[model samples]
Target: MNKTCPNCGALLIKDAWETVETNDNGSYVFKSYLALKCLQRCGYYERADQNDQE
Candidate 1:
């Protein structure tokens, strides 16, 4: 998922990684990795919108 800075409206790139996890019920779940953003200006980061997906 891509995120942006709410304060500064900076573009952020999320490096998602695939991984498997077992729950208490012995169920396998897939999870992706998340990344932080380096906000410019105000040093704030927020999630990007669907329209931002290009």
Candidate 2:
């Protein structure tokens, strides 16, 4: 899990301690990994989204 985005200094979440699965959909987790991003409508999140596709 990441506390701040590597590309940008943005908080991934409000919680101090958070764990995220790189690929989480519905009730399934495609892969177990850590990803950090800013949800403030930036290219970073988009890039991450695209990377997830691969």
Best by TM-score: 1
For candidate 2, write residues 1-54 as lDDT tens digits: 444555767755321223345544546334433343464535353223433433
In order, candidate lDDTs are 0.56, 0.43
Q: Against the hidden reference, what TM-scores do the models get?
A: 0.29, 0.26
Candidate 2 least-lDDT 10 residues: 13-22
Tens digits of per-residue lDDT for model 1, 22-50 = 99999999965444454464644334345
Model 1 weakest 10-residue run by lDDT: 44-53
**Candidate 1: lDDT of 2?**
51
Query: Candidate 2: where are CA atoms >4 Å away?
Result: 14-39, 43-54
Model 1 lDDT vs. the true structure?
0.56
Counted clashes in each candidate structure: 5, 0
lDDT of 2: 0.43
